[model samples]
Target: MDYTIEIATTDFITTESAVKGGADRIELCSAISEGGLTPSMGHIRKCREMFDLPIFPIIRPRSGDFLYTDEEFDLMMSDVKLCKELGCNGVVIGFLLNDGMIDKVRIETVVRAAYPMEVTFHRAFDRCKDPFIALEELIEAGCQRILTSGQQIKATDGLDLIKQLIEAAGDRIIIMPGSGLNPANIKYVAEATGAREFHGALRSSAESKMEFMLPSFAAIGDYINPAIKENDVREFKKALML
Candidate 1:
């Protein structure tokens, strides 16, 4: 395929919906509000049964940052083993130093643990104090692909850096664009970065059963401007067609 549409989804329902709406791959996981975390074995199994597309689980142990402790690294290793056993197509992970650099040691440990399956470095690369330095480390660490927003608040905002990264990658690694990708600009982002892959979450919050219980609902970025908009999967696909 010339274009790959990657949709980040938490539950099986979301995964199924994405595939039906034309997503090519699914980054299977849960607790997306906290970024993402490893999906349960049951969730992975359900997704594997439900869709033919590749499912890559997010192996992040916590949400606040990309920095991980020794305990967290061990947890990630264990998580990768379980993900492989459950037949996940790949695993997405990243680890960083306190000063915002790739933790090559931890990444190596994970790559070793996830043997035979593909590995993707997640947005943690965006947090790296230095993208160029981190990209080299990831290449050395043997990560096959990286999902980044060009280290900007939005992918569009970082178009220039993304272009440079794409040129620098030069087929040695995949530079998947994610974060702030929407139908309105996906085509533009792809053209600018020369990336074949795209990643985003297509979601809509209907009235939650417990809306009035205490909290109404959680929005991905702006809580105060909580306006419900259905996930824009089809729009993205349509843009890709043009």
Candidate 2:
């Protein structure tokens, strides 16, 4: 019953708000709308200065698939080193083969580079051909946790498999359900999966305060920036309490 909620934060504002609203930890990233990419070094440093909670920055080099080229893999290792230099508590990472299996060699190398810091294999596990086999591979690679939606688009839709994964994981690894969680279904997920950790964004949008709205021009890709609302984070935590 003593579960923890980790907020997926994109910037300093969301980081502060999530901590204020009682987020136990933070998964810092950029471009969350595109499934989260590695955040800037300045963002990681600023968050370390601003909060006392554990920070785990995503180590993905790009937005598309978990498969990476040798150069991309090198960039990811450098990012992991940078996260450690910034005093981040951990890093979230995942890599796969073209055949849809865990990239064991590359993953082990990355985890070794991360060193004493905790590492959670990200949703790339969902892309694997077999969840059970990938689960064992992650454990062998020394990951502390796996953030997954049971290989489905949403965790709720994969509740049965999530429960099975939790049961299979036992004390060997932590299985944290993420993707598409909200206040309404968090309780159900907790009860059904018996998981001790959960991850969510709990984000809402607010329009920019620019006086002159560009009727014909779009400066940024998005009109309304997505941010983590304190109330929504609080509500998600409250649901876990219940």
Candidate 3:
């Protein structure tokens, strides 16, 4: 079976590590703690220069719900255009109506603006009222893939539903299982869901390099740095072989 592992990267450091560890592609984003927001133009350009793998930058304007305001939608469009200008392979995006359905009109607009660049609907599909209905909408909107956890917190927890989605999707659109995937469960999720593409972040906690400790003030809340470990990435790829 032909399969590819996409690493959800937060910065250039992680990007370089993932590439070295054999990541086929990267979903470039910022604030991965908030479920991934759009990365800066500089980051995109730098990654493009640094890696030979495909880079699909997320187009989310902020770190909140999928229901975006008009201004936010405009900002997302600008980011899409910028991705195209920077020669990105694709753009990851999603939008939903207040009624908990796919925003077909707006999504179509964004897809049209994306043009030759591929579009992968993000986990915002999990928030929709109906997965099957939303799947059809995304396929109609010209999306190449849908990254979802099958309406659950983690892909392993939603294995059954993900299997159904993959069967339903067939050859029309790629149903990629993501969210909370790791080396421990990647093999199971891939075998169960029968999905060819998987998305995950092989992250680990790294202690800050500060010898002097600040007792009172904290710069980044608890000072715990969550970074992608090259060993973890290699393990994840190994799991795919199993």
Candidate 4:
């Protein structure tokens, strides 16, 4: 069976690492620790120019909740437009109503705005009121894929639902499992869920190289840098083949 690996890259450096590590696609973002946000134009432009891989920049405007105010939604629209203009392969997005239902009307509008670029409704699907209902709605909205953890914290823990979702999705859309997945368990997820694509940060961290540091700066939590390791990314792909 063929498998595709998507690496969530937080910046140009991590993006490079993912590519070198053989990522089949890139989910470009900023502030991945906050569960990903829209990356800057510079990051988008440079990656589009340099990489031969598909780059889908996440179109999220903030950290918490899939529900957004009108102003925030506008920002997301602008970001989506910018990604297309910069030649990104696609955009990742999600929106939810207060009751945890997908905001289908708004999502459809965003899909229209995205035009030729494909859209993958992000994990906000997991936060929705119903998985099966949202799955059909996303398909109707023209999303090419849905990145989900099957409404659980980790895709592994949600294998039963993930498998069921795969069965339910059929050929209507691609269901990619993500969150807390790594090289070690990717094969298991693939076999269990019968999914062809997978997503992960696959990150490793290193302390700052700076020799001089302010002692008080430690309070802000900036000492370590997290990034997708090339070997780790390679291992994820390798595991799928094995």
- Top candidate (lDDT): 4
Q: On a 0 to 1 TM-score scale, where does candidate 1 land against the true structure?
A: 0.89
> TM-scores of the models, in the given order?
0.89, 0.96, 0.95, 0.96
The list of candidate 2 runs beyond 4 A from truth reads 218-223
Which 10-residue span in candidate 1 carries the lowest summed lDDT? Answer: 221-230
lDDT of 1 at 6: 88
Q: Write the per-residue lDDT of candidate 4 for residues 21-99, one digit (tens) a residue.
A: 8999999999998999998899899999999999999999889999899999998899989988988889999999999
lDDT of 1 by residue, 6-80 (tens): 889878767777877778788987888788888888898888877888989999877888777778777888889
Positional deviation of residue 18's Cα in model 1 after best superposition, in angstroms: 0.4
The best-first sequence of candidates by TM-score reads: 2, 4, 3, 1
Residue-level lDDT tens digits of model 3 in 115-220 = 8989999999999999999998999999999999989988888999899999998999999999999999899898888999999988767777777768664555
Would you list the clashing residue pairs of candidate 2? none
lDDT (10s digit) by residue, model 2, range 44-148 = 999998899899999998899998998998888999999988889999999999999999999899888898889999999988999999999999999999999
Model 4 residue 159 distance off true place after TM-score fit, in angstroms? 0.8
Error of 3 at 11 (Å): 1.1
